[model samples]
Target: MRQDELWGEDTTQRYDTPGTGMFAPDVVEPAVHRLAELADGGRALEFAIGTGRIAVPLARHGVPVTGIELSQPMIAQLRSKTDEATIPVVVGDMATASAPGPFHLVYLVFNTISNLLTQPEQVECFRNAARHLIPGGRFVIELHVPDLRKLPPGQHAVVFTSGPGYLGVDTYDPLHQHLTSHHFHYTEDGQARLARSPHRYIWPAELDLMGQLAGFELESRHADWKGGEFTAESGSHVSVYRLGPVTAT
Candidate 1:
């Protein structure tokens, strides 16, 4: 599907449902705290800042936050919450868009880098973040580790999430490292609605290589924003990369 079609009006409208699931206080606090600490009273820029989910709150914490977003509908949803002066945003692709910056932190959270859908684009995303950062500045990414181990031999799909009213599955093309996440939300009357998005899944080591190519060095990697250990069984990670050299804190 086209990028615009993927995050168009209807998706933007339904994107935010505060204080539940991924929007829960507990789920958001760790990321906010960690990013705030990284910002260290300097400026921050968010890549693909949808509906200001993190940007709004981060700005309220006193960090000057700017964003680059491609979807106007999503930006409208954000503007409904605050004005441009509060949190400025540029409309364009994250991999190529330049936000006026020499920011201390440039973050792409919630697996947004996967939205680029190609290895070259993903690498460009790293370079874009580097371009916006000051020396010793940080670029962060929160993403899932492709769970290929869960896929039985010859099986191309796996159900990653299911709940009372929703189900989510991922289909993989191992040869190309491509993935498509399929989500279904059920109505009370038993009808199901579906949405799908494509992604190019990269391994953690591959991401580090991209960062290195973009003039960043791996600073730290955690299984979560809370600084949990990333291990063989961990399914996701929060990785920090720094421009030039940084002594890990």
Candidate 2:
């Protein structure tokens, strides 16, 4: 998949758009419901709000949410849903785009920031988020903790040929320090789309440093907000940051 096409037109979809294969089965319902609750209302902004998975429900719950997306098709698909037609959708790169207003909470969930490729850009994204929030506001990031050293040197591609042409492909460039994987499902239906989210993985320590460089103070890190301590070798991470020192009232 080309870099531009992968996240742009490929992802803007619905449940039938790909389902659990494209999205992890744990995406919605309790997990996403809990994620929405973290915002706690008051002009929330979600980065890379593809298809309104959490945004729609949060808005319905009266959160007054706004979304920033790079793909117009994704935004169109989001608005196509009756629930999100009226919600604001800003189309631009998340690293530089400004949201509609100062938000109490700015969340970039589903490991969206890893799409930026460079560490500097990721830090810049955090800074932009800081510039968009009120004092004491939050910038929340959710991602899976990556284990790269475990993999062999520059391991590029994991092919599981369980069935005919049903192979999984996970590639990495140790030299470039980036990893992205693609999974393909083939059937009589002809090369169907499964779950394919290719991200430039970063460890929790690296990401936390990026946030700090962007002028944020680490607030908390959880394995999951439902109450899980963030220890080494964890799978998922929910990192919260205080934007900046409060301006005196």
List RMSD in Å for every model shown.
Answer: 1.1, 4.1
Per-model lDDT = 0.93, 0.73
The TM-score values for the models, in the order shown, are 0.97, 0.83
Worst 10 residues of 2 by lDDT: 13-22
The weakest ten consecutive residues by lDDT in model 1 span 240-249
Total clashes for model 2 = 2
Highest lDDT among the candidates is held by which one? 1
Off by over 4 Å in 2: 1-4, 8-26, 83-85, 159-166, 189-198, 245-249
Runs in model 1 lying further than 4 Å from the true structure: 247-249
Model 2, 1-249: lDDT tens digits are: 533466555454433344564354455555456656666666788888877777776777777888888876777778777444457888777888887688888888767888888778888889889888888788988887766645675566655335675667667766665776666767787857676655677878888788778788888788875657878868888888887753311
